[model samples]
Target: MSKIESIDAKAVKTYARTEQTVSDVRSYRLARVIEQLKISNCPAILLYDPVNIRYATDTSNMQIWTVRNPSRYVMVFADGTVISWELHSCEHVWDGVDLDLELRSAVSWIFFSAGHEVESRCATWGAEIVNVMRDRVPGESRLAVDRLDPMGTSYLASKGITLLDGQAMMEMARLIKSPEEIVLMNESLRAAEKGIERMRREMRSGITEQELWANLHYENIKHGGEWIETRLLASGDRTNPWMHECSSRVLQKGDLLAFDTDMIGPNGYCSDISRTWTVDETKPTDEQRRLYSTAFEQVHFNMDLLRPGMSFSEYSEKSWKIPDLYLKNRYSCIAHGIGMVDEYPSISHQVDWTTAGYDGVFRSGMTLCVESYIGAEGGTQGVKLEQQVVLTDDGCVPLTSTEFEMDWL
Candidate 1:
């Protein structure tokens, strides 16, 4: 059974309260989406993404998440009441909510053709629910589905349902972090810290990147991070050039390792961090030491510069010298916005670094990950240091408490 399935109904309710409850975070999201819907005059919004569904109803019913087997759908009315389909597949979706928030009978299973498979039932159910929702709402209520597979799209079109792009609006809604989200993210950070520490203790000269990946990945899940992004470990000279693209290369003496991993927290909130470490006990080369120091300084410099109202591009200018002077890397840029993904609103190039719009201004309540990469003398070997931070009115708050010096191992 899955971690969610193992959760007793009572335990699930208490677990939600232990951190940020999904209802709190998602209620705000729903409010914003509903406001937009009113502006667009879109009567009902169909959410299909797991993240979206979690944001809307705090439920983890996978039967309704995939493009193939959607189990449930959520409908938010202009009056603020939300109706959602209840599915048996969801072990106990309502285990956490206040008892007062009763399930609406009208939102229950909408009948479709019999003898249908799981995926077919999901698609058919989605269409029928939307049709029922349309009939209940005023005349010509524009139906907006968050995300739909091609087959689902064709099915909707057959019924004359209009499709819309809600990515920007949804992303904008989730950009800010709530106190509860911050708590869960912090929990994830702790798990990441523990996993990295484990890697440090077990690492050896012959350890391969793939092996290290498995070590950190498994440890994270064992430590309460239910979902983890791919582990990236590039060692030796491989670290300098194609810094990304996880490889199966083995570790070697004097190899500099660079990596970044994300730990999934409660309710899908995430925490990501990166570090550079060296293998073997030999004294580091002067060049290697200098490059590592530069990367560390860059991460600190960017973190210190964060604050509300500061344009992201303006901050990039402050660290332009590090790349040019230390790494001989002239491509200086602003840091990216990070939340659901590592790259959101990717950094601005030096050419446009001074521009205002591209490098969005920093604001309180936003989370960002600052990473610095440096290649060996001829762009042959590279090193990177990254950390998660939450913007505060004064500056920024570091999510992971790890140090830059990877030698702590």
Candidate 2:
């Protein structure tokens, strides 16, 4: 079993967006940010999260690396003025992108880059940011910020800057999608489905979980995806508890392999789909069949409950009622908004609504994921299933084309 059969990845075709479509989406995203900024009465927004930066300006640098190291950032004024501080002289990354922004050299302030000069570096960074605040926001000291460390916050505060909740503002802005965004999202989901298909074709006894997971990564990148957010692939006994990441354990016949593809695909949009399949495509035991059927029921049941204008609480109340035996191991969220990443309004389960729930309306053009995890507290194996969809005035329409294992049941 050491020598696995060779597998070829299927070619993934995505929509070829025209220059006009790209320009339209960029303008729409910027307008949404400006609308949020004006609504919050903040003159500008300070973006550190690469995803948010990409939303504001269609430029992507070191996304995962920049998360830990704030190497780049952007400031979007309520008037739609964009000041982007790129890493060093790498401003050329935005060369042909249909966007207009004042590019400047980023002042690297993290200790890994600046070392002992972090304090002085903060002085340099704070000065530039302060100038923007003063110039763009006259008679206004408030600026929305998605993320910033205490040192940066203190320095900016010392310079008469007031920070608002930019994450909340941005979430509200990105909650609803524009027409052009949906086209790009279709392309992302298409690439993700191709990756899932490759994973399915390569699924077999003796294949390590890690090895199988790499196929997904390979297909994603080969087909224009950006990156996967996690390695949530587990097999057999590991599947019951859920949230277990993929590892080196080899697959065996009749084992259940569950995974959540939280992929950042083409155009930085996410295609968060989850599924559970049997290793070697073997006939599952009765218990495995039961587990998968229950999870499948939960996913679609909740998905059918979604509609535009429904409140989160109402949705939670009407969501699938997880049986008492599996309540403890249920997926944390019944549904959540999805866009460039998992965006606003996480709809909670009925029992968990009190603490984790908030109020929000389901709006047209909002993408969401219906999640399920079915397993008793000490069960031998579990099943996890999820579906990504677009919420419209009539109902929800699924985005992922990856098939479920209905025959196994």
Candidate 3:
């Protein structure tokens, strides 16, 4: 047996074979997609987003580049039929991962490829999609689509297809985690910790912010982690405004460095973690200490506040209320769902409820990140802290293992 096939389902089921061929994560995720399709009354989903495709079929090709290209795609029917298309050379790429999926050469009708023939080529792509939907899924004209170009959209619409929100269904399905997935996620989290540890060891007065940030990427890739979503590492003054991408500026001994490791780690699970640290052997300023303490308070307070049965609105209402000094520069949401990427239910703050709030219940098996960014309106420095956790009947079990700078306080 191959390593993926030999993996113990009780141990690392993520790489193990699916139920159709053997048993484990590939089957579990596909079942989640099917369950979601049925709940949404969607006959099938046409997946163009590489992340969605990866979630559905356990396969990939040029993941980042194809995000905007739409050249690679898949169709997953509610009845459990899966058909995928990729570059001709990649026809056998998925091989043993999903035994039931049919693979073919994907159509490329983007302007870059088709030029003057974009329309006609798009029509051909649309017709093939419709034919497959009719033949495989049979009666449903309603197709859930993650994304499509205008030509493809108009063409599919003219042919009596109603495109439901596939991304919503996928997000809903992804919010809850299976036991097996947690294992893979923890493995990815370990990769991130290795990366963070590298950063901590190399952190010093003379190191540039870019040099520090590169350590995270190097550790992630060296350990089989795929990518980091953001370049959010800053020291000293750059920390004050927040969201500053890492730069080449040399650091000073007492500077406060902050970063968010939006890493898409192994098995495509994300480790969206953040922390602020002091550069080298220097005493933190009183202002710096205050910021770290406040941010930590917010993160832990909200992390403890959440429960399995609480509604999203109630959670927000009773959640950590940001004080006046730090209100303006709050993190976008108290928390958000995490899976292959930042997935669903971005719980806004109470002040943001008027426009951004939505209602839902926090449920068991859902993984979340509690967030905090503390900086006064015109402050000179700030602290960003976040914790990744999974909810169960007991309470939040932390996925993040990085120790906070508690000694600084």
Q: TM-score for each prediction?
A: 0.77, 0.95, 0.94
A best-first ranking of the candidates according to their TM-score comes to: 2, 3, 1
Cα-based lDDT at residue 358, candidate 1: 65
lDDT of 2 by residue, 58-156 (tens): 899989999999989999888887888899878788898655578888998899999999999999999999987777666789989999988999999
Q: Which stretches of candidate 2 lie over 4 Å from their true place?
A: 1-16
Can you list the residue pairs that collide in candidate 3?
A: none
Residue 37 of model 2, lDDT score = 88
Better of 1 and 2 by lDDT: 2
Question: How does candidate 2 score on lDDT?
Answer: 0.86
Candidate 1 stretches with Cα past 4 Å from truth are 1-23, 26-41, 61-73, 83-88, 98-126, 154-160, 243-245, 312-333, 340-344, 351-359, 376-378, 406-409
Full-model lDDT, candidate 1: 0.63
Q: Pick the candidate with the highest lDDT.
A: 2
- Scored by CA lDDT, what does every candidate get? 0.63, 0.86, 0.85
Error of 1 at 205 (Å): 0.8
Where does candidate 1 clash, by residue pair? 63-71, 64-71, 240-381, 240-382, 376-381
